[model samples]
Target: MTDRYAVFGQPIAHSQSPHIHATFGRQEGLALDYRAIEASPGEFLAALEAFAAEGGVGANITAPHKEAAFALCTTLTSRARRAGAVNTLLRKGDRWHGDTTDGIGLVRDLTDRHGLDLRGRRTLLIGAGGSARSVAPALLDAGILELVVVNRTPERADALIDAMGEPGRAITRYWEDIRELGDFELIINATSAGRDRAAEFKLPLSLVNSMTTAVDLNYGEAAIAFTAWARSAGCRNIVDGLGMLVEQAAESFLQWHAVRPQTEAVYTELRTQLAPLAGED
Candidate 1:
């Protein structure tokens, strides 16, 4: 039987998961079908159960569903436990196993794909949501000296730092104190701020210097806010989340199929495809 796989999340219509997985399967000469499954918050568990019932071997979870997926798992990888979120899932009999590839994906995209040296860099992470939680440990593992997490809700940032269990390396600061934090070698946006068309990122330019790399873990329209702010602040290396998306999909593909497919061909293809859509996005 051909392998059945899917990604589940609300607002999933625009997901590139199906395309990325299809390309990966084709590269490995596998007979597989991947799909984008839309599931609202109330419907997520039921929708996932239905997918698993239909021979689905694995799946990806995004956005608001990561924590939900984490809770639904029978077993989880240590990284997922640390993240308190799940972005990848596997089925075994009637049970689900969960793991998070997001952090490794972001690290690889930055270090391997983008030629970044993450070791010893001082980093600032915006927001304390699941995405921020997902990447924090990985940055520390990659040798970043310190991470300052700032969020609109100070408690969420405090909770994230507390959960990280690295009080010396990870610290929380109020968003209002952003200007006082000084410059960082890296600034990562893990917030949902840009998803709304009317929302704009108003970060202080003083937070970034010419050597700083600014990244938003969101792509397309959701990335506009941080990207606009980064450009205006003269950040030399500005990135959206597209590369991380493909990289993480590759990690999930390897976990399911035992083979890692090359990602640049698909990444370049998607970049070209999206270039024309940039204006509309």
Candidate 2:
């Protein structure tokens, strides 16, 4: 029987996981049936149970369900523990195992794909939600010498820092407190603020410079606010989360099928498809 899998989210119609996973399965010659499931907030566990009962080998969790999935997991990878969010779920001997691959995905895209170095670099992250939580531990592990997390809610920033525990080194700042931050080697926008069609968030121009590279964790329509700001601010390189999305799906695919699919081709193909959407935006 073909292994069953899916990506679950509340508003899942917008997810690209199905396409990415289909490419992965085809490339690896795996018998897999992956689809997108629109899960209700309260129905997450029920949906997981139903899918598992139907022989789902694994599934990917998104948005509102990441924390719920983390809470429901029988076991968690170290990264998942640090993230306090679970974006990937594996079915193991009648139990659901939770792990987050977002950080690894971002790091892989940054270092391996983009040829960017993280060691001893100053990194600024501009969100304190699940996306930031999922990527922080991995970014710290990637050898970033310093990281500052700035959020609209200072308490959220503090909570992210506290959840991270004693990082090798990290700091928290409020949006208003970061006026003097500048010349960051890497700046990541992990906020959900861009979801609005008229996103009004603005950054301190000092925080970015010619040397700065910006990454927005939300892709498509949601990334425009930050990426557009990055471009306007004279930042040379700006990346959205699409690559991270595929790379994370690739990791989940590996967990289910034990086959590592070549991501470059799929990435290129996805990028081409995404370009038209970007243009539409």
Candidate 3:
């Protein structure tokens, strides 16, 4: 029987997971069925149970559902535990495993693919949400000199830092504390403000320069907000999370099948598909 997998999210119709996975399956010569599943908030649990009942081997959880997926897991990887959220899920004999691969994905894409050295670099992560939480530890582990998290809700930032517990390096700051924070080599937008189509926020122009690289954790229209801000602020390098999206999906594919698919091809294809939305010529 062909193995089955899917990506579950609230508004999953826009998901490129099925396309990415199909490319991976073709590359690896594996027989599988992958799809995008839109599950309402209350339908998440039932969706998982039903998927598992049908022999679904694994699944990827996105947006409004990562935390809920974490809650449903019987076992979680260390990264997932640290993140307090889960993006990838594996079904064992009687239990499910949950893990977050976003950090590794981002790190790999930035360091390996983009040749940006994170070590000894001051990094700014903007958001206290699950995306920031999941990627922060990995950034610290990558040898970033310092990491500061800024959020609209100062308490959420504080909570993230507190949960991180002096893991050697990382600081949390309130919204008002942003101007006091120094400029950084890399700025990461991890908030949903972009996804919600917010026109503006207290994005710090002073904290970025031509040398700084800015990245948004949200893709498509959502990605435009931060990237546009970065460009308007004269930051030369701006990247949306589309590459990270492909990388993270590749990570889940590895976890399920033990084969790391070549991601550049799929990444290129997705980029081509997304170029119009991004206004890429």
TM-score, per-candidate, Cα-based: 0.95, 0.93, 0.93
Candidate 3 residue-wise lDDT, 34-112, digit = tens:
9888999899999988888887889999888888888889999988888888899999886899999999999998887
Q: Say which prediction, candidate 1 or candidate 3, comes out ahead on lDDT.
A: 1
Best prediction by lDDT: 1
Q: Candidate 2 — which residues are off by over 4 angstroms?
A: 276-281
In the range 181-237, model 1's lDDT, one tens digit per residue, is 999999999988899988988888889876898998988888888888888888878
In terms of TM-score, which candidate is stronger, 1 or 3? 1
TM-score of 1: 0.95
Query: What shift in Å separates residue 213 of candidate 1 from its native position after superposition?
Result: 0.2
* Model 1: colliding residue pairs: none
Predictions in order: lDDT: 0.89, 0.84, 0.84
**Comparing 1 and 2 on lDDT, the stronger one:** 1
Q: What is the alpha-carbon lDDT for the whole of candidate 2?
A: 0.84
